[model samples]
Target: MNTRMNSTASEAAHQFIVIEGPIGVGKTSLARRLCASLSAQGVLEEGAQNPFLERFYRNQRAAALPTQLYFLLQRAQQLAALQQQDLFAPLRVADYLLEKDRLFAQVTLDQAEYRLYEQVCAKLDIHPPKPDLVVYLQAPVDVLLERIAKRGVDYEQRIERAYLERLNEAYARFFHEFEAAPLLIVNAASIDPINNHADYEELLAAIRRMKRGRLYYNPLRSRGI
Candidate 1:
């Protein structure tokens, strides 16, 4: 945690916040910043630690199963560890949700591979903590592509546009029916919360104010011209 990023704790309404979105939508970056601002513990996934990730980017069909499985196991372990920690600790923020693992498996794996993945899931019997608030980010495919390019991860740059399209659709459907927690959907394409101080502060204010129900954070609509 960079000392420069730290601030007096915002006293967020939610003790546990999960930041979710399609790849390149800046979930991880926002999660880290939120952790700093809220003085929260971060339960971030180690996506780079997955050995099969680069290969999966290059050849989705060939490496999808192993890649998904590795992520599943890794994320499950991280959440399980979180579960074991003291329940009354400070606010906790995470970059990914356990349910998204199955979402990815559905999008990436073939029919035959999916059956095996399901069996593996059944065997693991994961039980992730329910988040008090979920902040879902949304952006256009073009924005996603541009952001991904700007990040300049060698393997990530190999990602296909078609795959990203499917992922965006999958995320849309998942969040549409999501009812496990209070949902706050932000139009990430309209706000650069990561680099812009005003934008981050405004969004952080919205986060601390949320209690229940689904809310959309569209600066354009909120501004009312």
Candidate 2:
């Protein structure tokens, strides 16, 4: 255990912060930047490294359950680790939510498999720490496809545009009724939080001002950046 005191000055005031979005929507990028800006530790999901992922991309029907199970177990372990961390720390940013596991499972697994998976998940004592803020990035299917192609990951090359479209819709529907945390919905179609410091600063400001409930941010409609 890394038993360093939770330095008050370095603490993020909000406890846990999470950045979530569909594949290639810049969740990891934003999470990394936020962690760096807040001088906090980051817990990022290891996506491409999953052994079953490549095979799943090739044949989702045959590989969905194993891939989903791998992810569920991995995320559960990560959350368990997070639960043991010092809460007094300034900030901790994570790239994924345990609940979001169901989104993929529903989309990929059949009815019977999904039900079994849910049962296994229920038996696990993995309860994630509640995040004070959740930044949900949204982008058009075209934009997501373009970004995914630009990244040039081999496994990701098999991702069809149609699949991404459905995934985006699923996310929109999921967040539409979500009330678990203070949600900041961002239109990431045009904003480049990595290279554009102005855009990044604007998002940081929005996060700082978040008091409760949900807020939407569209960089294309915001003031001069």
Quote each prediction's TM-score.
0.92, 0.91
> Where does candidate 1 stray beyond 4 Å?
1-12, 221-225
Off by over 4 Å in 2: 1-13, 221-225
Q: Which pairs, if any, clash in model 1?
A: none
- Residue-by-residue lDDT tens digits, candidate 2, 42-112: 98999876899999999989999999999999998888887686555546889987778999998999999
lDDT tens digits, residue span 1-225, model 1: 334334344453477899999999999999999989767899998888999999999898999999999999998788889888864666799999999999999999999999999999999999888899999999989999999999998899998889999999999999999999999999999999999898999999898878789999988745334
Whole-model lDDT, model 2: 0.86
Candidate 2 minimal-lDDT segment of 10 residues:
2-11
Per-candidate local distance difference test: 0.90, 0.86
Estimate the TM-score for candidate 1.
0.92
Model 2, residue 106: C-alpha shift (Å): 0.3
Candidate 1 weakest lDDT stretch, 10 residues = 1-10
